[model samples]
Each structure stands twice: as structure tokens, then as C-alpha cells.
Target: MPPPGQDPRWETMGLVHDYLAAEFPLINKTLSLAKVNTYGLIYEWTGTNSSLKPYILAAHQDVVPVNPETVSTWTHPPYSGFFDGESIWGRGASDDKASLTAIMLTLETLIQKDWTPERTIVLAFGFDEEASGIYGAKYLGKALEETYGRDAFAFIVDEGGGFKDVYETIFATPGVAEKGHADIKLEVTSPGGHSSVPPVHTTIGYLASLITEFEKNPYPVELARDTVPYDNLVCMAAHSRDIPRSLKRAIFRSGHSNAALHRFEKDFVLQDKFYSSLVGTTQAVDIISGGVKSNALPESAFAIINHRINTLSFVNETAARDTQTITSLAESLGLTLKAFGEDVIPESFYATSHCSSQSSSTSSSKGHIELSLAFNHELEPAPRTPTSGKESKPWDFLSGTIKATYYSHRAQGIKTETTATDGDNVDFDPRNVDGNTDTKYYWNLTRHIFRYNHKNAAYGSEIATGVHTVNENIPLDHYLEIIRFFTTLNNECR
Candidate 1:
């Protein structure tokens, strides 16, 4: 995979393309492979039955840039692609190169076996996903729409939630949905004055109070069993033997004893780092600026609040609610404020109006407060992929392949260890991915978008698939398991 923010060279992709063009001449002649937007690669293995909508296996061919200062800290060089007799160490080893390799190898194997599908299969690889898909999946999605039309895919699969052991049981978590993202900007302006003669609170001081309010009153938490994350906990409780019986019973009877279920989830499930993100919209005051000089009270203050909207709420709604909360808080603090974005006045007009309205209070109205949400990029919560009913065939096939990948080894008198005890068969759990993937750009192509990558570890061992960090690597055995899963899924997805 090429490093992030660069052109979609897809050096690995080009190599695979050339190899297939030479080795599998028949496949080269039959399947349609094209580079979309000069960066995204799309390979379509046309099916005998054109009536069936195609299935897309999507993965990216880009990795985040490694910090130069951290180079000496790595066991192997970041881009060395070293095999240390146990795992492959490199920057993109686990994140996405593994998935790309698995897809190409699976296709090559299928072509060698002379295998043909009844339904079409598409392999879509985006090259600039790490830099936010502007040049890759976004254009690929548009090209696909022009070629295959909207809703032309049976399902789209991408790298996201993976199989992991939790509570002594393997949970095959295919990310059925993902959280939305937004960046809100807050600003305040006041009459400039000498620091010695300033009011009780300056513009920066009011901004600080607003930030405190946001932290004190975060988005409300919901633990209803119907929610995706809570439901997943319920599924885990039902399958894992390590969970307390009382907690399992509370989860099972969540609908009947709502308070008990909420308490149990808040005390137990939310304690985990992964599950804490799912319950509510998370707010972080990531950036702040104020005060230009030590001798003068600054006239302006600015802050940027980043939010990850939970699957339970819509992005627009979450933003609106937060705007209201901030506006109310500012008003309570005796600050004359005007909110921005959705039902709030335009920033230019609001600032101008405030500039004209002279001295409403003894302290010149305790400074004019401005709340605006200038979203750098915003995305709504992804559509939830179905896990039940006839339309869930793709999910069922993917889960079955994961199960088969681990279970086949056990059947051969091989000991397979998950986070669970040896010989414990892992079960599948449908849940939303906490992080976003390239699949976000392809939502228009299909409702059945699944974000999954295989990564369950043996009990007491580290899950070494560290993304965007130093010492990134993937266990060789786990890499093989990924390939096996993809091979099985490729053959069975129809």
C-alpha cells in the first residue's frame, strides 16, 4: 500500500493486475478491470447470471504516514516489509495491505481453480483512503454509479470491525454501521480594554465557561437493549461463560427491567474502552485560541469542538442539540450570544448586528458571545447492515466463512485459541464499527455495506494489529487466516 496523501499509485495493485493479465489469460479476457479516476481500481468478475446484483469486496491500498522521530523505536523498519519468523512487520501490514493481498490472492486462486460464480463479484481498492477518500473511493463510487447504476450491488464489504475475543469468547464483529463525524467552531468577541480594567470575565474567560458546560453536560447516554452496542453486549452475555449470571440475566431481561439493564451496562460494558464510544455523541475541545497580548484583554476567542456522533443519533440532530445547549449555557452566563448553523443567524449578519448594538449592559453586555459550527467535514451515521431475514445472505456468508476458517483447524485435532479457552467455538455478533472506513463513501451503492477484518487473538496474547502507530505488525498465521476467510467468502458469496 502507498503511504497516505499521495497519488493512488497502487504499486501492489499494478503488479497483481499485470500478473493476472499474464497468468490468467481467460480471466483477463472475461473480467472487466478498470482504474477509476486514475487512482481507484475496480475489477469485476462478471457472473453467468446478470440478473443478480453484484457483490463488492472493498479495501484500501494506503497507510498513514509514520513519524520520522519514532523510526528507531520499531523492531523492524516501518517500510521494510520484514518477516521475523512469526509476523510481518511494516506500516501497512495489518491495516489494509493484508486485506488487499488477501483479495488478490483469493482471486488468483479462484481463477487457477477455473471457478466461476453464479453472481458477479467486484474487487474495489481505493488508494487514498487514509487521506479521506477524495481521490479514491469517492471517485470510485461515482464511476460505479455511472457504470452499474445505484443500488447495483448485493453488498459492499470493507476493512472495519474485526473478529476479536471478548469475555473468553470469540466475537465475529462485522461493522454493520459506523459513527458520524463533525467539527464545530465556537467564537466570541468582546470590546478590547486594558487587562487591569477588564470585566470579571473576558472573551476567553466566557469561552472557558462554555467548554466547562459542554464537559459537564455531555450527550445523554442510552443503554436500551435495542441499540446496536447494547444488543451486542446482550449477545456476548448469552454466549460467554465468564460473565456474571446476574449481569447476564439483566441483559437478557433488559426490556423488562430497564433500570437494572442500564445500570449494568453503564457499570460493566461502558467500562471497556471500545464500548464507551457507542453510548453517546463524544465531544472533545481539541483546539482553542485567545489573547494576543499580555497587557490587553483580547477581543476575540475561538475554539474547535470535535464530535463523533453515535449510531443512535443523526449527525444533523446531534449538531443542533449541541448548538442549543451551548447557546443556553452562554445566555445563562449573562453573555449576549447568537448561535450559528441551523435555525441560528448567519455569522456575518450576527457579528454585524452585535457590532451595531451598542452598550446593552453596564459592562458593555458582558461581551458578545458567538457560537458557530463550521464543520470541516460532516457525515451522517451509516446505514445499518441487516443481520436477519433473506436479504442478510452476504452477512451470513461472511460470518460462516470466519467460523469455518477457525473451526476447520479444530476439526483436524489442532488447538485453536481465541480470547476464549482452547476449543471454544466463536460466535458471530453484528455491531457498529467505532471507527469509519472507506465504505462510508460507497453507501450510495448499497445498503448492505459491511466493515470487517479478521483479527481474533489467542488468550493472553497481544492483538498486534496496531494501526497508525509504531511497531505495527500482523501475525503470519493470522494473515493466512484472513486469506482463508476471503477465499471461502469469495466462493460462497453468491
Candidate 2:
């Protein structure tokens, strides 16, 4: 909505913090709006957390940098927060700010009623999630681990919606696993030569051919990443009366179901659930750069490939193999993978790779392994290196919160744990509903995670698109609905 530097409109981050303090005293700890750099900010709202155990609900404030050309395409001004005939418009409105507002409102409402809980609640509002959450949530999450152990809170909830893109893809849509972005750089080098007296081959030419090979080869397509939570999909496919008989047979393998009927329709769009889960290895080239001048025979060429490794099993191996594959392909054209940067981590030609090294990976992979590598080699990935310290595993504390919340909301039709978010336009709320996908994060941690909020569901597709896009906005009605959802959830949990 605003240029890179300044936007006259909207509240400055400091003002937002101050406003929250003024709005409620029980947000009691006040807000910490900080910037380690000009571009990053991390904010925290500490209210009542259980001394016995803690809980966290996170939302981000910064929206994606906007594209001006596409600004006019929106129904309303992108940053205006304009309330037209129906929806409210503005950047960060839908993607996260709306959720932030809902969390704020829910907390403020509870505080006014003097509501306190058995578990402490930490409202972690991050800035720069759009920038991959490095300085914001990731940093804050690390802070918690440092202070209270890996399982600091019973759970942590962040930016995600409740439902699916289209109704047909899966019986239920859960944001079970987000593809962690593996940002990479592929570089090629060679001795420079004059273009006029060019040697038969130049570095740029070699690199160009390597790039072509990467493009021609994509990670073998796995229908859906297993991280998608196939169990939930199977659950939805089995007894969902909403599905037709022929379609249901293909989706679910019930006793009365015919495998043949589903075989022919295996290409069904809903099969994406199965496909995504089944795929463990995938490769993608994210960026490419090279060459010095048009008249010069460039000495080098390079490209960045973004790969999302399915799970820990193949990340390092796949990336190295792929990088080596690219190297071989390039060398065939006469080129190499020479890495730069003074602090380059000496990756093993024989070690595990971290393609999706985002917070989730850190938590899922490093949270335990890094802490225990030296002591427990079996737990560590291949080429196990010894670490100085010990690994800290996830706690059993989450089980209590899950059980408590489940019983608390059972009467309200909240059968969340095994359920997946399914349906576009569904009302998605994270605080107290099964409508969100945070369940998946715990699946690997706790063996099972479910949704407890049943009221409103929003398609993950719609919410996810708004995530790093221009005109990031959400409807006020949706905001109010979520606020209502949490308020009810809070009361039920009580």
C-alpha cells in the first residue's frame, strides 16, 4: 500500500502498541514493539500465563510489500481499510491483522471480565512474517525456548486459515504442514576471456546450459506432501455423507467401498491430499543471476533454487545430490557449485540437509536433534556430528492443554484433533477452534492434534494467498466472527 519508505496513512507500529496499552490494563505487561533492523519488528503482549504452564497465540502485523500496478485492481484501496458495501479493505487486514485484532479483542474482552486461566497465554504478535519470520516469530520463539524450554507454551499458533481451496480436493483441508522454503544459490565460475577473441566456451554459456537442465527436471511430482495429514483426509473421505457414493469410494476405503471405482478416478482433484503426503522429495529453482557485460565473455553464472524437502529423511541428501547433479550437468557444459560467503557452513557431501529451515523445521528437526546429537546418535540425522550440548524434546504439557480444551469445547461440537480444515470461505480462527491447522505441527510432536473450534471455517487457499500479497485485507464481519469464536471458546475452556 505504501512505498518502501513511508506511508502517511495507517498507525505506526509504536502507536499500535500504545493503543493496546491504553485499551486494556490487563494486557498488563504492555507491548514490546522492537526493531533489530530498519526492516524488522518483534512485538509481545504478555498477559496472564499459567505459572504452572504457558500457552501462546501468535499473529503478525506486517503485510507483504505491495505492487502498485495491481493496486487499482482491488475492490477497494489496498491500505485504505475501506468498508464498502460488505468487506473492509487494507493491507494486513485479512492475512493477519484481522487475526491480530480478533486476538486483541478476545483478550481485552476476557481481561475486562477478570478472566484468568490455569494456563498462561502469551499473545505473540510478530512483524515480518512475510519476510519469512526471521526477526519476528522465529526470533521470539527461540527466546521462549531459551527461557522456558522447547515446549514453552502448551501450543503456539500463527498465520494460517482453517479450510481448503476447493471442496473436491480432500474431505478435510488442514494446514498440516507448510512447505518450508529452502532458499538456495547456484553459482558457476570460470576464467574470463575477451568476447572478440573468445575461447570456444565461456562460464556464462556453461551456466546457461545447466539452468536448462534444472528447468527440464522437476522433483518427481508426489501427489501431495505426507505432511498434509492423510489420516484426516481419510477420515473425511470415509463417512462424509456430503460426498457422493462414486466419489466417496475413491476418497475413502470403507468396508463397503470398491477400490476399482476409485482407481479410475484416482486422478480426482481431491487426490492432492494423498499426493502431497506421499511426496518426500521435491526440487525447484528459485532464482538465477550471472554475467558481467554484454561485450565481455563472463567468467561466471549462477541461479538460486528453492526446494521444499518433504521430511527430514531426504533434505540434505536430495539437495546435495541435486546440487551435485546440477554441478555435473554444468561441468558437462564446463561449469562448478563454488559457494561464497566467509561463514559458509561446511555442509557434508554426506550429511542431512535442511531445505525448509524455517521455524517449523527448527522446532521439528533441531529442537530435539541439535540438543541430543552427541548423546543420541540414532536420533540425529546422518553423518552425525557431536554437539556440545544436549537436546531438549517437546513436553507432555501439551497433552493437558489438548485434553482440557477438548473437554471444554466438546459440547460445542468441537471434535478438532483429527479433523482437517475443509472448504473455501470457511471461517478460520486459531485461538479456540479446530478450524485452524496448528494441529499438524503437534502431530509429529504429540502423535495426534485436532481442531476444537467448529463454528467458522475459511479456506486455507484464500487466506494463504493474502499472506504475502498486495491489498492484504480481511472482512470486518470475519473479524467479528472470529472474535466471537474465541470469546465462546474462552468461556467453554473456563
Q: Considering every candidate listed, which one attains the maximal lDDT?
A: 1
lDDT of 1 at 270: 69
Predicted candidate 1 versus true structure: per-residue lDDT over 101-196, tens digit per residue: 887777777888889888898888887788778778888888888888998899887887666666767778788888887778888887888999
lDDT of 1 at 267: 78
Q: Write the per-residue lDDT of candidate 2 for residues 1-494, one digit (tens) a residue.
A: 44224644434655665655676665545444444333334344443544544555666667766788888777667777787645567776766677777777787777677766545555556555655454455555555555556544544444453433233332222232343324456555566767888766566566566667777766554333222333334455554446567656655543234454345235653346445333434455556666768788776666666555543444445545555455444333422234322212222211334333444333221100000011111111111111112421111222233333323443355433223333311211111111222222222222122233221242332332254565455544455555655565445432
User: What number of clashing residue pairs does each candidate have, in the order they appear?
Assistant: 0, 39
TM for every model, in the order presented, reads 0.85, 0.65
Worst 10 residues of 2 by lDDT: 366-375
- What's the alpha carbon RMSD for model 2? 12.3
lDDT of 2 at 384: 15
Q: Which regions in candidate 2 have their CA more than 4 angstroms from the true location?
A: 1-12, 22-52, 72-74, 164-174, 197-201, 222-229, 242-247, 251-280, 336-467
Give the C-alpha lDDT of model 1. 0.76
Measured with C-alpha atoms, the lDDT of residue 327 in candidate 2 is: 45
Tell me the alpha-carbon RMSD of every candidate: 4.5, 12.3
